[model samples]
Target chain A: MGIKQLAKLLADEAPECIKEVPLKSLQGRKIAIDASMSIYQFMIAVRQGGSNNPAAMLTNADGEPTSHVQGFFTRTIRYMSEGIKPVYVFDGKPPNIKSGELVKRREKREKAEKELAAAKEAGNIEEQDKQAKRLVRAGTKENNDCKKLLELMGIPVVNAPCEAEAEASALCKNGEVWAVGTEDMDALTFGCPVLLRKMTFAKSGKENIQQMNYKKAIEGLNLTHDQFVDLCILLGCDYCDSIKGIGPKKALAFIREYGCIEKILENLDRKKFTVPDDWVPNEKKAKEAEEKEEAEYDTDEEKEKTGKPKSDADEEDTEEEVVPIYVKARKLFNEHEVITNLDLKWKECQVEALTKYLVDEMGFNPDRVKSNIEKLQKAQKANTKPQSRMDSFFKPLPSKAGAKKPAKATVGSKRKANDTKGKKGAFFKKR
Target chain B: MFEARLTQGKIFKQLIEALKDLVQDANIDCSEDELSIQAMDSSHVSLVQVNLQAGGFDHFRCDRTISLGFNSTNMSKILKCAGNDDVITLKAEDTADALTLMFESPGQDRIADFELKLMDIDAEPLGIPDTEYQCTIRMPSGEFQRIIRDLQVLGDTCVISCTKEGVRFSVSGDLGTGNVLLRNNAAEKEEDQVIIEMEEPVELTFALRYLNFFTKATSLGGSVILSMSPEVPVVVEYPIEEFGHIKYYLAPKIDDDA
Candidate 1:
């Protein structure tokens, strides 16, 4: 997934970097949320009936799913009622390097679809429900519906060029947002200034939002920004496979000692670690290969187009060079394409229009929709004053014997409070 | 067209046997003077070069210079079909896609021919600079082979230290450490002597896995020569009788701890 179990690792090693804050403290602050991740969670969690008909999704009269709309609509109104400025960032086209992950997801969905049909034939209600949840994907239709709903609510929406977490982190880095709010731990690796988890809870007043400060985390771990990225890559990101024997603790130790993956790899005992066959290329060998390919530069297409006679060697040398995948992943984390100069202006909520779109067009209850719209209008009217900056509210908590103790409570609840059932590995049966 | 005849066919067979493990495919550049081959292993950590002068052949003729590309394993398989004392002739046209081999027994009563398919191998010629080494050691081929094989059992790498007094090969691993030292000795037979010539002392570490592969050429010569310098690849040379030699260039492993 995203730096597998990175939050736990950070909590155990650098608890001083994270702090628990009351949800009310986020008032008058701009938070950028990853819309695709939230929508996927809603599709997995929101269903019609409890035990008997778990496969029945919340749908309108035309039998189209309305669960994401219901969840996103209520969540947006809740944020507005708390005097919070929310900017929704939607995912764009995934990078080419993520094709392998996409293929795996597709294969899993197809297998689940077949299993679902068999369950339906056997009249096994529980099995059908499990298989149906495995098939839930936040595809184009759901994303478009969420975009339309956000625009109607007058919240600023950003279509990220790649991953939404990276773009949301960019927005936070540029000071346009106070923090990037998403459950994915890779927001830290994306270099977000402040990462807020448990922001999308279902009206839970007991659980406070967990805040992780990027600068403090780096200082506590005693690593540079580049070394932190290497640590995440080693802990297994989406782009490449990690070495067989390395886990989070060993990965952190190696980063601290060797300073980077290349050095760690050179000094590591191959007999002990048993590195992945195609994990990372030896730099010297890759350079020599590049030189050899450059010296024999003759394209088969050039021969065809220019009427030059093609030699047999041209066919043999046409195989492309192998560029290691981890290099691409590292580059992506360093420089993800986002709208750098953001003009995110939160506008007034169109009360009448939002009511009609939600209640009449989306088959929502008219009374509840009107009440939520009223709350949005009232909060906007009271927020006519300029919003406060993050630094004004957040003085780095004093590092005392008790300051680090608060992180354990928040991190412990944060781990168990992840109700997002559509987590990457949760759909498969554990071996 | 090109054709070359060799009286002792087994030499060619032994040459292929020495190279096939290190390189899969290579191009042999043939000139009026000699036949030369240069190729690096897939890992690029080691290189092998072979040079055979035309004067050493029983009969040699070449109108112009040409290059022949082949897979070493396939060439070795074809070479194995010849008898030990057979007269072997290699024939190929300028633009032919296959090389022709003919073998005749010593009595001239038995004759056989085989056609081996050629491949289009694209190899870049490396510019190997000729530099004077600091130390050169000449020892019996069997002694070098035994030392490499014995040290391989202890560790994956070997540190070679050469001085005016003698040369030492040392290795260490989880099991323990081992070292073998050889002093300068002049025996009655030239091949039995162990000689060391040095301008300055130099020590380098190399992966023993590749040295073990280089020892496959022990059957080609009575003695082996090792040339070493600082921050450079060591040259392991096995000289053939009067024709030329097969030299292996192995880059030393730089120990960051050292």
Candidate 2:
């Protein structure tokens, strides 16, 4: 079947799981986008319309940031208007297993970029020249402007420690988001319970939209979540390359019959199965490694207790653990007793400090400062009743003209009444 | 659906050349059994029509009828590319907006796809005149090509005069007049130069560029025939194998000095 037909079938099979929600609700819901994937799709589509630089990075005459800025603002605003709040996650250090793919992609892009630069410098002024520029700009802008636009929209962007999509899938698994949105089918294997396939253009068409229920998907394959993980591992994941001669269907069958990784490995014929040299079972070896690691840890702790110099490895480790002083200070301030007592962690430290310093150093009453902090924090948290609070806080002291005078006007008589019995004194007070 | 045939590649080649020169508004028609195209120059005084028959292609085989809807400008662009001596195939793919042309030669094969765009060229209302006081001249394609080539050296205007005895092509400019004459069947006459004349004489002036373009059609045929009335349009026709003919119409120049 074609991609469209497959998409239709998937959509039909998974209706309730893929039911459309108001874009507003999707706001604050984490979306895991395959950065390179989405940008490439956009580039291809735009080029089909014969744009001069369909992927061209745009710049003003002065050569400031151009193409990416426009794409980011325009596309993000479009998404926002459609009620899909977007958080653009950018890729960082790729895992070692993907190094080969990264090298190939880098070489290809470098060649393209060099050609584009030459075209620009030559002043060709042809349509193809414009197209080359567009392609280059599209790539550069994909990284820079897309991130900035998300920030401007008040969306939370995460620079993943590794593959952004994988991190995003983890976010969904941890209930930090409603679903993980990406075009890659591999995201399901990454353990996202709700994998939204066409989140980017879902609003535009019902045809391409596909939603997979991770639970249902796993059930359909007749494998538990762990078995599914093993299936992907057997099929080759970034954590370990796929075992040769094993594909998705075969891997599923292997996992289903064996029930565990150890059993599957045991059942495999030794001659037929050649494990990759780097295919270390880090998770399986974790317990025994921890015990051996703990024994080494004791020697380090002993070195810390005594005044002896730490081993070279230990010193290297401490150097790694050294925290920047500003971070330390921020942590201290966050846990400060005064800040904690008043529940003002969410307030700006500058604002809180100014109010406290004014009250303490300028002889402002403690009660008044406390009340003001409460009112300010409340107003900041929820934007209601600010005017009333302002009026009350700034109201003038009672005027002398409106003060009531003492009824008897005799200090000696007051002293005699104070000396009288408690019952008579209480009655006088009531009267 | 329409089809037409040509024996030598020259007819098709010259037709393409002429179409390239004419503005796209000159609607040319083609059919399976016959092909005809007629158009007038800017002055509307001359009308040219080119016709070809199916039997001209007896050595080859083509039976399908196809009609092409094209803007003349675009059609010219599509036809400008012709491989020498290769049988060109033109077909419209089932209701598609495009037409495909294929050219085949040893180790060299090419297919050009052109989208057929519709044009709105109104047919000229002026009919071919039935003037009796006229002249007809037959001459070798090379002789006409040579005179046009020489006149182009002077400038972009030339005069043609035909009489019972001979035909004269002359161009004059700041440099001086350049003239060429072909008398009936002289001793130096080659088999290629055949001159024909009528009882009366006819003379007319035309733009060098139009004549230059008109002669290009001769590349597809051996010779061209000139039919004229003094102030009327000139009809240049090419006779190919069997009774097939391709014609072109060009208006006469209005004499400002007169």
Candidate 3:
């Protein structure tokens, strides 16, 4: 759950921050798409049959999962036809801070696997369908498959150093893309200038493309970017545990009042909030030494079981540090590792190779592949012409700061104002 | 064990009604002397603190101090089951997961018992420093409620200015500006009096939205107290005769346009 209930909170509290734009409006924009998130969605949505049928994972002849390819291929074609240049960002190694969350996900997957087996044994179709969806994991294979597919289509694919969302946000910040496209709200926490949600939506006509303006959001909420990130962390993020009782509304209040997690934690009542035991960041060097000792001690048993050398085990142990999860989480949000100096160039789709790869290797229908290839070529041809927006014709002038300055200035002096106000004998300072 | 019985059960019911909309969950701290609660509204823009003295209850017993956390909405639902004249008895163990509420009708012919699940509410107990207000304006609770309600129609924020002459509540919106002034009126009925005691003049602006919510306590008191100092949160108090008072603290909106 990336910033749980964030969309609702934004809609409720800062309606001006989100815009519902028609798909056609994005005609000449480059969007850095979170590949893993979309792939996972495809795995859930694209099944063997319709919704009424058994939700079996769609696979190629050799049982290789092809649902992601099927969904991604069609979606890319749709986006291309709309003249939207898509840059797919794939996840590399996740940050060490995410290990706990990954472990929890793995445990959940295992439990779902067991439940699926039980449901299969019981012949409960509905239960099996539910468990199957829960078991979906976009692993390395899916990532590589999409990478190859996008490469064939000449759509740029960036393999992020840690997280795809961060990489996508970085690309947007670098002005390589107009927006970061994904359902995950954490991209905003990573400071993506613009975040587009429901971009992967099937044309059901029920939903509109939600464009969230980061600047407008912070301005409307009266928060600095750092404070916004703190609010996201408080709401709930993948890299660390959130305080149990604080929901979205309360989290925003805390962030607004205290400014940062450190100040909030400093002032929080432990009896009420129940801060975790290991809330502080651990000493890295000490933790590694301790883990290395444990690894050395476990070597005898490892040697007896798998003939693995003590040196190899020690090397593996050395890599795992005991940094407090939230600290690492915040660091990742602020300064995630990405290939910053990226040279992105969208080229003509290799139609022949794409058709052969999709139709022959992926077992896609030949006629459908051919038609999509044609559509892609048509979109590419249309995109080659210089697309000039209204702003491109004129030099942008400095925005009038008169209206915004007073609001910001007042916010800056609010704490001080309150402090002096409390000095007056009649004032009641309600905590 | 902890138990407190109130003869007028409607007070408890009305109290829940006043609090439920503003607060979602809170802990009711019961001691030998009094039962108290201190909670900030979900937005933290305002706070509601309640204090009910033990002596005011028909019967009160507390072997040890206990904190009972509950969802105010759920609490309201449970309280709604009691009749207005019912004698409400609240009981809980020293370390309880739920609080038991037993309500007996005045006729003693009907009785209802509700066990409300306790929540682990994580809220810091805010320390409210005592202050002698620069100005204290006391007016009929109904009148105060009407002013807040009427001003809400005019604007989002209400500007309240108190002077030696009288107190003024003013609001300006896109449509127009509205101002209501109340001078010191010593009516035959004490509750109808508009009384103001001031050392210095002060003007403050507050969000009328929250002030309107605070007015839900109008039925609980005959008069409402408005205490204020410059640049600080104004305290709105509704006294529950012989028992306690429900106080709301709302910070004034720092005028950015000013």
Which of the two, 2 or 3, has more DockQ?
3
CAPRI tier for the interface of model 1: incorrect
What are the per-residue Cα lDDT tens digits for candidate 3 across A1-431? 57788888888777767877667667567899999999999999898765555678888778899999998998998888776788899888877657678889999999999999999988888888999999998888888888899999988889888789999999899887889999999998999999999986676534579899998888878999888888888888887788888899999999999998878877988778866533543333446549676432232232244322111222134433333345556777887888876878788889888988888789988998888888888777656542323222222233322221211111112211111121211211222
Candidate 1 Cα lDDT to native: 0.78
Q: Can you write out model 2's per-residue Cα lDDT over A1-431, one digit (the tens) per residue?
A: 00112223334433323433334334223355556555554544433223443343333454443333433434554444432434555666654435444465567667777766676677544644544533442344456555544443344566666566666666666665557667765566556687776555534533344556777666556567666656555655433344677655566668779985557766877578665433423322345458667322232233244332211223222232222211221221122111001111111214455344434433445675465545434333221111111111122222222121122211112211111121211110110
Which window of 10 residues has the lowest lDDT sum in candidate 3 chain A?
Answer: A409-418
lDDT for each residue of candidate 1 in B156-193, tens digit (9 for 90 to 100) = 77889998779999999779999999999999899999
Q: For each candidate, what is chain B's TM-score?
A: 0.97, 0.76, 0.98
Pick the DockQ winner.
3
DockQ of 1: 0.00
Model 3 CA deviation exceeding 4 Å by range = A50-53, A204-206, A281-324, A394-431, B1-258
lDDT at B53 for candidate 1? 93
| True lDDT of residue A331, candidate 3 | 71
What total of clashing residue pairs does each candidate reach? 0, 28, 1
Backbone clash pairs for candidate 1 read: none
Q: What is the CA-based DockQ of model 3?
A: 0.01
Q: In candidate 2, residue A10 scores what lDDT?
A: 32
Tell me which of candidates 1 and 3 scores higher on TM-score: 1
On residues B1-258, what C-alpha lDDT tens digit does candidate 3 reach at each position?
A: 789999998999999899889887787877777888877664456788898999999899987656677889889988988888899999988666678999999999998999987755434456666778899999999999999999888877788999998999999887899999999999999999999999999998787888999999999989999999887788999999999999998866653210
* TM-scores of all candidate predictions against the true structure: 0.53, 0.34, 0.53
